[model samples]
Target: MSQAPTTMKASILAPGQIAPNILSSIVVFLVALPLCMGIAIASGVPPAAGLITGVIGGIVVGAFAGSPLLVSGPAAGLAVLVFELVRDHGLVALGPVVLLAGAMQLAAGLFKVGLWFRMVAPAVIHGMLAGIGILIVASQLHVMVDAKPLAGGLQNFGALPGRIWDVVTSKQGLEAGLLGLGVIAVMIGWEKFKPAKLKLVPGALLAIILATAIAQVAQLDVARVDLPANLFGSIEFVGSSGLAMLLDPTLLGIALAFAFIASAETLLSAAAVDSMHTGPRTKYDRELCAQGIGNMLCGAAGALPMTGVIVRSAANVQAGATSRLSTILHGTWLLGFVVLLPWLLRMAPIAALAGILVFTGFKMVNPKQLKELAHFGKGTLAVFLATALMIVATDLLMGVAAGIALSLLLMALRAAYLHVSLKKDEANKTAVLRLTGSATFLNVPRLSEVLDSVPDGTTVTVDMDKLRMIDHACLVLLQDWNRTAHARGCKLVVDWQALEALSEAGSKRGRVQGLTTT
Candidate 1:
C-alpha cells in the first residue's frame, strides 16, 4: 500500500526543530527589545510602543504570514516618517493616524495591489533599502552617545561634529566611553562569531548581555535606561484629539504616508523571502493581508506600525529557523519579558542596539552588488544613487519615486532610439527589412516610426529571419501596424518561416502566420 501524501510530507518543525526555534527566539528577542525601545524613544512615542509592535508582529503576522522565515516588527525605515509626524502633529495625534493607516493597508491588501510589487525594478528596490540603511546609521549616532536625538534628519547630520566635540569635553564622557566600548564589543563579536557553530548562543545577544551586566556591577554613573520608567509608563489608547483627529486632512496625509512606506517595505521584504524559499512559493496577497492585520493590532496596542523586516528574517535563517514557529517563539519570548522580566529588559544598553543597527546598515550597502549594478547600465546606477541620495536628503518615499521615474524615462529613451528601417523596392512595389537584435518595450517607439514612415501604396514585408528577440511590446506594435496598413490601401505580407525564426530567436516559443497583403 502507498503512503498517504500527507504522511510523506516533511514537517518544518519536526521534534528537534523546536529547540532551535526556542533558542533563536530568545536571540531575536534580545536583538529586538532595545531596538524597539530606542526607535520609540527616538520617534518621541513611549518606548513600550515599539516592543508592543514587535510582539504583535510575531504573534499575529507570524502565525498567518505566507513567508515562514520572515520576521515582522517595527522597522527603522519609518523612523523619519514617525518623527516628522510627531513633530508636525504632536505625539498626542499620532495614535489615531496610525490606526487609520492600518485600515488603509487592509484596504490595499483587499484590492490585490500586492501584485504590483513585481512591477518595481530590482535596482530601485535595492537603492531604497541602501538609503534606509544609511539613514539608520546616521540617526542612531546620537542615541549611541546618550544624547537626545535631533529632530530633522539631514539638518541634524551637520551638528554631529559639534556634538562629538561636546561629548569629548564634558563629564558625560564616562557614559560615552562605556557606550563606545559596548558598541565595539558587539560589532567585533558579530563579525567573528557564528552562532550555529557556537550552539544556543548569538554573539550580538551575548555582547549586549555582558555589557549590561558590567554597567550594573561597576555602578557606572553613566546614563542607563530606567526599567520602571521605560516600561509601563503612561500609555493612552485614545488620544485627546480622538475622532476629530481621525478625520483631519493633515492627519490623514500622514497616515497615508505611513501606510505607503510600510507597505512598500513589507512587500519588498516579502519578495526577498520568496527568492530565498527552496520549496513552494509564497502568496504575496496573503502576505499583504497578514501585514495589514499585524499593523492594525500593533497600532491598537499602542505600538508603532509593523512590517516584515529583512534583517531579522535573515537572522532567523542564519540561526537555523525553518518555520513560522521560530517567529512565534520570538514573540512569545518578548511577551514573557514584558510580563515577567521587565526589569532585566530595561538593563539593555542603547549602544548595543546601535551596534546591531550599524552592522545591519553595512550589510545593506554591498559594494559587490553596486558593482554588478554598474555592469547592467548607467541607468541602474543612477536609480540606485538617486534613491540613496533622496532618502538621505528628504525621505524614503520621495527618494524611491524619483529613482523609479528616472528608470522609466531611461527605458523609454532606449526604446525610442532603437530604429529598424526597411529598404524600399519601387520596381515590385514592395519593401523588405531583415529585423535584427532584441526588441523590447524600449523599442516600441522606433518600431512605430519604421511602420509610419513607409510611403503610401507600397507592399511592406518584414523578414525576421535575422531577428534575435521580439518581446510582447514589439509584437503588439507589429499587430497594430498590420491593421493600419490594411485600412490604408497598402499591402502587408509577413513570411511564416521568417516569423517562426524570429519567435525562436526571441525565445517566445510562438509562431506567427504568413499573411498576404490585402
Candidate 2:
C-alpha cells in the first residue's frame, strides 16, 4: 500500500534482475520440491496433485501477487482439512469443493474483506497451526515406518506407541523407520551446524537427497514417491461428475471453510513476507485475489489448495530474489522436473518425505510463541491451549470454533466488567463513588443502585478515573441523576472531561453537554 508495488512490477524482466531471480527461483524450487509432494501425501492425494498446485500457485498466483517475494503453494496448514474432506466425500469431491472455495475467495477479495481475516485472534491462528502440526506429526510417524495412518488425528496419536512397537518387531519396518529418523536427524543437524558457505542450501533438500542415496545404497524395499510417467497426463480435470458436487450443501459448507482458512493463511503469510523485505509492502486484497484465481485453476486441475507458505517465501527473500520472476520461475522448474524427469522422483522414498513433514510439523507447534502469547494475559494462553487440545480431540473446524467462542466470551466478560466502591468522607460532608473497569449497559443496574444510595446527595463526587471505558447508558444515567440532584440542595459532582474522553465517539459531545461537572 505504501508505494503501489509498481516499481517492482515494471522491473520484473530487468537486465540485472534475471540472474538473481533465476538463482533464487532455483533455491525456492529446491525447497518446494519435497514439500509439494509431502503436503499432497498428507492431504490424502497423489504427489502430482501437490505439484499441480505448486505450478499454479507460482506461475498464476505469482503473476498477480502483491508481495513479490512471497511464494504460494500447497500448504501443510490446510492438509488436515483436505484430509477430512477427502475422507468424508472421497477424492472426487475435492476438485469441486476447492473450485467453489476459490470462487468464494475471489468474491471476498472483490469485496475487500481480505483485511478482516487479520481480526482473527492471534492465539487462535497459532493454536490452529499447532494443532494441525500435531496431527501431521502423529499421522506421518506411521508413514515413516511404511504403515497406514489411522482414520483421525486422535486415532493417529493414540496409535503411536503401537506403531513404535511394530517398528521394533518388524525388520523391514525397522529399516524404514530408522531411515526416516536418520532424515529427521540430518535435517535438524544441518539446521544447527551447516557450514556458513552453503547455508542457502535447504536442509530439507539435503535430507531428501541423502535419504534417496541411502535407500538406493541399502537397496531398501521401502515404498517410494509415485509420479506419473507424464505429469501433464495426470491432471484430473473437473468434469461433469465433479461439477455435480456443487449441489451438495455439505460440500458447499466445506468450500466456505476452505476459502476462509486459505484467505487468512495467505494474507498472514504476505504480511510476514513484507516484514522480511524493504522493497514493497503487500496489498492484501490483491494478494487474496491472486490466490483465489490460483486456487480456482488448481481446483480445475483437481489439485490440492494453495496458500502463501512462509518457509519458501523466506527462502526466496534470503536467496536474493528481486521480483515476482523468482516465484514464477520456481513453478516452471517444478513443472519441468516432473515432466522431464519423473524417474528421478520415483526414487525418492516416501518415508523420507514423510519425515520432512514430521520435522515441519514439530516446528509448526512453535512452543516459543507461547511466551509471546503469555504477554497478552492468561485468557489468551488459555485460548491457545484450548484450540490445540480441541483440534487433537475433534477436528480443525471445531477447534477453531471453540477458540473463537472462548475469545468472544473473554471479550464480553471484559467489556461488561465493573467494580464500584463507595467511600464516605463524613468529616468533609461528602461521598465518593469510585468506578473501575468498563462501564456498559450490563453495569447500569449496579451503577444505578450505588447512585441511588448516596442519601439524596450531600455533595457526592462520582470518580471514574480508573474506568477503562464508560458507555452512553452509564453517561445518560449520570446526566438524569444530576438533573434531580439539585432538588436535595446540592449537585452530584462528576469528571466531565474524563467521561467525555472515555465515551464512545459521535455521542460523546451530546452526553457530556448535559452531565453536571465539578
Candidate 3:
C-alpha cells in the first residue's frame, strides 16, 4: 500500500475529515476570492472571468488532482503574459490561446513529460518571477489610481514617477490613489500585527473588506469592480476572431508560451504545497492533467487560465485541510458567493484589488534571494539578473530563453573544458605533462601542444590520474603521442590501465566528458 496508489477521494468522505475540510475550505475561499478577481482585472479581463477560473479549478481540477491539499485558481504569475496578449491582439484572442495552451498541457500530461519541467534552472525560474513582479507593480500602479496602465512594462515604469506626483497634487486621481494606498498599508500592518486567534484569516481579505467599507462610508467616487448580476452575462466565449487567431503563428507561439509557463508554475506550486503538508506527495502527471482540465474549462467559459496557486494552498494547509474535499468545497464557496452577492463584489473599489496585487507583485521581487543566488556563484547570479532584467526590458519569452541559453552555454563550457600544465624535472631527465580538467575532443589541440613541448629522448609521464574526465578523442590523441614518443626514444611512463578505466567508466555513463567526473 504505497502512498502513490492511495485514492484520496475515499478519504475525503470519511466523517473524521469533515470538520477540518469545512474549516480549511472557508479559509482558502477567503484567500482566493480577492486574488482571483485581482489577477483577472490585472490581465485586462472582466472580474467574473477570474471567478470562473476559480470555480473550474476547484470543482473540475480538485476531483482529479494528485496533490489532494493543493488549491488552484487564476494566478498573478501569468497576468503579464495575458495582459500583453489582450493589449496586442484584443480580448478575443485570449480564449483561443488559453484553449490551445490547455490542450498542449493535457497532451503533455498524457505523454508523461511533466517531469521534464523540473530541468528548468532555478535561476531562470526566480528571474522570471522577479521580472513578472516588476511588470505587475509597474502596470498596477496605474490601476491603483483608477487609470489604465501604459502599453508596456518599460513604458509604465518610465511614467510611474510622474503619475505618483499627479496623484499627490491633483484632484483627478487623488481619492482612488489614497484608497489603494490604504489597502496596501492595511495588508502590511495586518500581516505584521494580526492576533493569534485571527492568524488563519488572510490579510488580503481583511484589507479589502476594510477598504470596501471605507469607500462606502466616505461616499468615495472611485471605480468599483464591474461584475455582472448574472454570471453568464460576463462570459464572452471564443469568438470568430479568437478562433481565426489560433491559426496565426504569433498567437500559436503565445499559446506555447502559455503552456510552458503555466505547467512550470502549476507543478512547482504543487511541489511547494506538498512540502507544507505531510499527508501526500504529488503525482505530477496526474496533477498536470487536472490543471489541463481546469484550464480547458476556463478557456471554454471565456475565463482566465488557472494554475495551482501557492497562496490559497498555503492557507488551506495552515487552516487544517485534510484532503481534496477542502479544495473542492472552496470552489463551491466561491460560486455561492459570486451567485448570491454579486453586488458586494461590484461594490469593492477596483483600487483595493489593485493595491493587493501591487503588494503581491512587490513580494515577488524578494531582494533577499539576491544574496542567496550570489552564494551559488557569480554565474548563477548573472543568470538571475539577465532573466529578470531582460523580462523588464524586453518580454517574458525572450528573457527566459536568454537565461536558458546562458545556463546551457556555461554547462557546455564546463563539460568540454580542460586545463593543461607541463612540469619538467630536467636534472632527473624526466618531463611530466599534467591534465587537470575534462579532456575531450574540444581539448585535443591543447593536449597535443603540451605533449609536443616535452623534450625528445627524455622519459615523459602524462598524468592521467589528475584528469577529471577523458573521452575517446583525448585517449586516441594520447596513444598517438605515445607512439611518437617511443619512436623519438622518449619513454612514456603512462599508466594505461587507470586511463582506460576512466574512459570505460565515462563511456558506460554515456558521457563524453559530462558532469560526472571520472
Candidate 4:
C-alpha cells in the first residue's frame, strides 16, 4: 500500500516547479544563443547550422529527456570533432557521418550500454575538458582581436603574440579588441557585483547586450554578427548523395568516432547535472536515445552534431529549472529570436561572442579541480597530468587511451607489491600465512613461493581476513594449493570467508565463473 504513494510521487510535478522552469528557460535561451553561433563559426560552419542543431536538441530531446534540467545543443566539446570532420570529409560528407553517428547512438541505447561509458577514468574525462578548453581559448582569442584563427592548436597558440602586437599597433583590429575586452570585463563584474534581485538574468546575455548598446552608441567600426536577411529562409538541407558515402569505410569510421565521443560527453554531463538537483535522477539509456534522435535531426537538416553541453546544463540548474519545460522553452525562445528578430542579433559584435567563449573555456580548466586531484596522491596527479598533456599534444581518443593504460599499469604495480607474511608456530607444528591488501594475478608468484614452502604433515592455516580482493586467477591458485596440501598429508585450514562472500554475490548474478572453494 505504501509503495503506491512512492510511485505517485515520482510522477507528480511539485507545485513549485512551474515558475522556476519558465524563468530558467528564458535565461538559458539568452546564454545559449551566442554560444551556439560562436561554436558554429569556430567549427567552420554557418552560424545558422548551429542554431538548427540547438532547435532540434531543445525541442526534440527536451520532450523525451531523462534528466529534467540537462540541456542539449551545439556543444563546444564537439566543435573540434565537427571541424575535423568537415575538414577531412568535406561539408557534403558531414551529414552522412553525423547520420551514421546518430544510428550508433540509437544502437547503444537499445543495447542498454550507457553504464559501460562510465567505466572511463575520471582523469581522462577531466583532461579532455581541459584540452578542449585550451583549444577554445587559443582559437577564439584571435577572433576576439579580429583575426582569423590559425590551422592547428599549436599554430594558434604561437600566433597570439603577433595578433596582440597587431591589435596594439594598428587601427584595424583595435576597436574589436576593445569591444571584446569590454564584454569580458562586464562578465567578470556582473558575477562579482550584480544585485541579487536581477540574478535571474544571465551574465553572458547582460554582457552582450551592454556591449552591443555601447558599440551602437559610439558607432564603433567593428564587425557585427552577419546573418541572412530572413534567418529561417537561409536553412539548407543535406544533399541526397550523403547516403552513398555511408558505404565508404573511412566515412563510416568517422561516424562511429563521432557517436562514441558524443555519447561519453553527454553521459558525463548528465551525471554531473544529476548531482546539482534533488529531482529525479537521469535514465542514461533514455537520454542516449533522445540525443540520438536530436543528432539524426541535425544530420537531416545539414547542421552540426549535438551533445549535452555542461555550460548550458549548469546554467539551467543554477537558474532554478525544475522540469524539462525549461529546456523546451529555451529552444522555443531561440526559434522565436531567429524568426522574429534577425536585426537585433546582428547588433552583437563578433568579438563579444568570442569573449564569452574565452571566459567559458577558462572556467573549464579550473585550478581548484587540479588541486583536488593532486591532493589525492602522486599516482592520481600523475594520471591527471599525463592525460591532460597527451590530450593537448595529441587528440581526445589517444589521450583517453593513454590515461586508462597508465591507470591499469599503476594498479598492477601496486597489486604486485602486496605482502604475504608467513609465521611458523613450532610448538604446534602449525604454519600461518596472512594475506593483506589486493590479491591480483600479479601477486601470484610471491604467493605461490610462500605457500609451497610449507613442510608435509604440517597444519597450515591460510588467513585471508585482511584481503581486499582476489581475482579469479589468484583464487584458482589458492584452490589448487589446497588440493596439493591435502595430497601431501597436510591439514590446510583455509579461512576464505571474504572470497566466499564475493563469489557468492557473483554467483547470485551468474557472474562467478572459474572460481570455486573445493
- State which candidate has the highest TM-score: 3
Mark the 10 consecutive residues where model 2 has the least summed lDDT. Answer: 1-10
- Residue-wise C-alpha lDDT for candidate 4, range 1-518, written one tens digit per residue: 01111111223558876787788898999889988888887787878888878888889999988776889999887787687677777888877788778878988898999778777777767777777778888888988877888766778889898888877777668888888888889889998999999876778888888889988999988888887767667666666677898888978877887898788889999988876766688899988889888888888777889999877988887777767888999999998888788888889898898898888788877767778888877787788778767766776567667888998987778765667998988777898989888777888898899888887777888787777667776888888888878788777786566575544354454443444432
Query: Residue by residue across 8-82, what tens digits does model 1's lDDT show?
Result: 111365787688777777767766776677667656676678888888888889998877777889887787678
Q: Any residue pairs clashing in model 3, and if so which? A: none
Candidate 1 vs 4: which has more TM-score: 4
Candidate models: Cα lDDT each: 0.71, 0.88, 0.87, 0.80
lDDT of 2: 0.88
Deviation from native of the Cα of residue 129 in model 3, angstroms = 1.0
Which pairs of residues collide in model 2?
A: none
For candidate 3, give the lDDT. Answer: 0.87
Q: Could you tell me how far off, in angstroms, the CA of residue 438 lies in candidate 2 after the best superposition?
A: 3.0
Q: Write the per-residue lDDT of candidate 3 for residues 296-370, one digit (tens) a residue.
A: 778877899988877888788778777888999999999999999999999899999999999999998899989
If ranked by lDDT, best first, what sequence of candidates would result?
Answer: 2, 3, 4, 1
Candidate ordering by TM-score (highest first): 3, 2, 4, 1
Which wins on TM-score, candidate 1 or candidate 2?
A: 2
Off by over 4 Å in 3: 1-13, 239-241, 421-426, 444-458, 466-468, 476-491, 496-518
Highest lDDT: which candidate? 2
Query: Which is the winner by lDDT between candidate 1 and candidate 4?
Result: 4
2 against 3, candidate with superior TM-score: 3
